[model samples]
Target: MVRQFVSSGSTFETQMGYSRAVVAGDWVFVSGTTGFDYSTMTISDDIGEQTRQAFANIAAALEQAGSRLDEVVRVTYVLPDGGLFEQCWPAMRDAFASARPAAMMIEAGLASPEMKIEIEVTALKGSAA
Candidate 1:
């Protein structure tokens, strides 16, 4: 099977030796993506806005891998404060209301204090149909 690696131009990817996502056959595995806007390298303080930005980053990676949010089959969310998870529900629902993939959430410390949330996803290419 041919495997392809997708990059989001984030310096961390290079420094950490990882791709934004990897496509293996019909599967796309997106790395844990944060809310920092790749273009500006800035992140929002609000959890809701951070959540939306994280989803946007994930969507971009999935799109680059020949997949989409609707094709996602599994998702994992990490937040420094579990209580803030509720604040992300609206954005999460908006992004995955269609696919409604199996999901999990974990409370954990992020690399930086400014990083409120990180999301990772797995998608099966063309699975949405």
Candidate 2:
């Protein structure tokens, strides 16, 4: 099987020596994605907007890997502030409620102060990988 590398042009991706996602066979492993609009390189101050953008970014990565949000089997979320759970959950539930992928939430600081939330997902497509 050939290993595929994916990048979203996020500075950390190159600097840290990792792709935004990797595809091998039928599995797509997405890296921890922060809530920033790569097109504009901006993060919204509002947690809701940031949460939504983070999922959007994850979805884009999945698309790049020949998968979609509905194919995601697992997800993990990291937050700089645990208190923001209320702010994050609604958006998350809204995004994944239909797909209902197994998910976990944890508290941790991101690389930058401006980053409040980061999300990662694992998707399975086909039955090869």
Candidate 3:
């Protein structure tokens, strides 16, 4: 199949010149997704809630790219505070309960202070890989 893009309808996708997810053949590469609730263009201050929202955002993009969370083959988590990883486990567990995609975490600065977490993932478009 030809390459395709999935848009989250976020203004950043235009301003930043990036898609929420890109589908190239059978693989879908999702961009780093933050906790911003696109509907309201706002984010939660709590790390746990932000983690959940980040996953929700990623899931939405994956769905648009003809994939689902359970099909995710790899996951990358970026956190501004390493200490908050524990706080994010429940949400992560809920999302990856079955698939348990290959995962990694890194401590890094994000775009803004309120943004605590960002998630990026790769999934097979037609099947779980």
Best candidate according to lDDT: 1
Per-residue lDDT of model 3, residues 43-75, tens digit only: 998999998999899998888887899898899
Error at 106, model 3, angstroms:
0.5
Q: Which stretches of candidate 3 lie over 4 Å from their true place?
A: none
User: Which pairs clash in the backbone of model 3?
Assistant: none
Poorest 10 consecutive residues of model 1 by lDDT?
33-42
What are the lDDT figures for the candidates, one per model?
0.94, 0.86, 0.90
What tens digits encode model 1's per-residue C-alpha lDDT throughout 27-81? Answer: 9999999899878778998999999999999999998888899999999999999
lDDT of 2 at 58: 89
The CA root-mean-square deviation of candidate 2, after full C-alpha superposition on the true structure, stands at 2.4
Evaluation by lDDT, superior candidate among 2 and 3: 3
Angstrom error at residue 70, model 3? 0.2
- How does residue 19 of candidate 2 score in lDDT? 96
Q: What ordering of candidates by lDDT runs from best to worst?
A: 1, 3, 2
lDDT per residue for candidate 2 within 1-129, as digits (tens), equals 999998887777778899999999999999998789988878999888999999899889888889888788898988889898788878888877667888899998888998898889888895222
Q: Which consecutive 10 residues in model 3 have the weakest lDDT in total?
A: 120-129
- Model 3, residue 126: distance off in Å is 3.6
